[model samples]
Target chain A: MAGIFKVKAKAKDGVTKVKMLAKHVMETGQRKDKKTGEIIPAKFIQEITVQHAGNTVFSGQLGTAMSKNPYFSFTFTGGAKGEELSISWTENTGASATETAKIK
Target chain B: MTMHRRTVVKAMLACGALVGLGAVIPGAAFAARNKDAFSSDDQAKAMQALFDAEPANSQDIVLKAPSIAENGAVVPVTVSTEMTGVESISIFVADNPTPLVAEFMIPAGTKASVATRIRMGKTSTITAVVKADGKLFSTARETKVTIGGCGG
Candidate 1:
């Protein structure tokens, strides 16, 4: 299955910048559907891990306070052009997905 | 079989504690939410629970956010620091329903910088705490929210 994340990486000045956008509703279990008026269950990315060359460079723990379709940007050292940067995320419902982006 | 039943109960309790501990262990892969900190209304208590050590004010840390947020639902926040050996970065909203917002772990090779959008229930001070070399440093800035996030 195609994961919900669109990621980009670019190498510059000994640092590789990574930007990611994930599609998610990020329901905090507080909002109600307009038609049904029923509470939406919390569904947000709980954890994210970013790896390059089999080593984790960055990881994050997130909560419901994040906005819908979260956007994350960070930079790390030691990445070269065409190198693979793998990103993975696990949601509150125990669903997880991983995708890789080549450094530009 | 009585002993077996007791052992099963004991094992279940142990598993529960492990799950709870996983959440608070910063670098653990199977991280669970810091429920107490994220659910806390008091900023001080949330900070204490999230980072056991108090963070000293630091000039090395750079926190960027809007002076006034047009929409509290998605306020852009970016934090960066030149501190070496940065282990993690955490963001907190002083007046949110749950003060603790997000925490990021920066392994050795990663730069001590991150950007994300956080929800604010109202106008409040936003704090970015950086952990480096087993010490905590922080910077805070006030951002006015015109409309409340987190469902107000």
Candidate 2:
């Protein structure tokens, strides 16, 4: 599903800090079937990557164990004011999303 | 022959009683277990590989979370670390379906601070893993959610 993502980047003292929020269900699929009493299958975002100035600085593999609407904040070096950063992810079913922001 | 028939009937009645009891007991127990859920072994192992161990307590790390969350859908969490040479920061909800919530790699020569909102299916311990200069440091806090967020 197409979800909402927000990215904010701020630069100070030659460093850039980025904060991102992505909306998702992040279902673990272990929930019980209320009527039949069986476990549901797991589904969640499997991979996430953040790129700054064409270099991969951060990456992670998330499982169904993560809570819904995952949010992340981190900092990186060497980004001048107004540099563009790209954040992207691929869900378990191969669905993908990307959000970009400029250093402020 | 009559004794044999009596024995068979008694055994059948006992089996029926056992099945009925099993159905009722497990339902109640499952409900109780659902109230507090954590990741399975494999899931925990997967998270462990991605997460570096953080010792139970540290003075340099500050974990900010509500003492009690009225709603599980959105619980604000903030982790700020003062340790020098910090490399990364990560957050994990111990009792959520997925224990690995988010991992962040802090580039060299950058400040170590992260703040965000996360969902909590139920009451859980939130852990912060901080990687600094090739080593790991950590802290945690237990957050109680009155209403479940993920519909557990």
Candidate 3:
């Protein structure tokens, strides 16, 4: 199955910039369907982590306040070109996914 | 017999308290511990739950957001700092039902900066708090929201 994240990273001037877009609905459990008039259950990313060479560069604890299809951008020092960065995330509902991308 | 995830999580929390900050552990316990912060509707409750201390306003950090966001559903925000030994950056929207938006951890050697989009319920003050070198520093800015995003 295709991963739920689109990750891109680039290295320049001894810094690696990483940008990611996660696929999620980010329901807050407050909205109600027009037909059913019932509250929608909340589902969102509870945590996300990015690792370079087994060291954490960025990790996030997210809530429903984040917009749908959350996007994040961050940078770290000393990533070489073509080096692989591992990214993973676990949702509030216990679902998770992992993906990797190479620094350009 | 397999150990329940929640049981292991409880153990992780204990380990964290046992070992100052529990930097040695390698699980998602940090996130699990802050689960209550996500659901907090009150700013003080969320702040205390997340940092265990009050944050002081500082000029060292930069918070970038629109003065007036036409669409509250997708407001872009960025937090950056020149301070060294930074640990984490957290965003909060005062008017949202859940004040805490997100918290990003910055490991050593990583730049103390992050960018993301968030939802806002109305015109509100958005605060960015940075924990660096064991000190909490923060900055706030007002974003006028014409269209609320909470879908409520």
Best by TM-score: 3
**Lowest-sum lDDT 10-residue window in model 3 chain B:** B20-29
TM-score of chain B of 2: 0.66
| The candidate that achieves the highest lDDT relative to the unseen native structure | 3
- Backbone steric clashes in candidate 3, count: 0
What are the TM-scores, per candidate, against the unseen true structure?
A: 0.84, 0.68, 0.86
lDDT of 2 by residue, A1-104 (tens): 45456777888887777787777777667677789887766667767887887787666545454557777766767788888888788876668987777889
Sorting all predicted structures by TM-score, with the top scorer first, yields 3, 1, 2
User: Which has the higher lDDT value, candidate number 1 or candidate number 2?
Assistant: 1
Q: In lDDT terms, how accurate is model 3?
A: 0.89
**Tens-digit lDDT track of model 2 for B32-142:** 221111233333453455542434457679999998999887788888888888776767787776666666566555457777677788898888878877677778889
Worst 10 residues of 2 chain B by lDDT: B32-41
Best-to-worst order by DockQ is: 3, 1, 2
Worst 10 residues of 3 chain A by lDDT: A1-10
Candidate 1, residue B32: Cα displacement in angstroms equals 5.2
Better of 1 and 2 by TM-score: 1
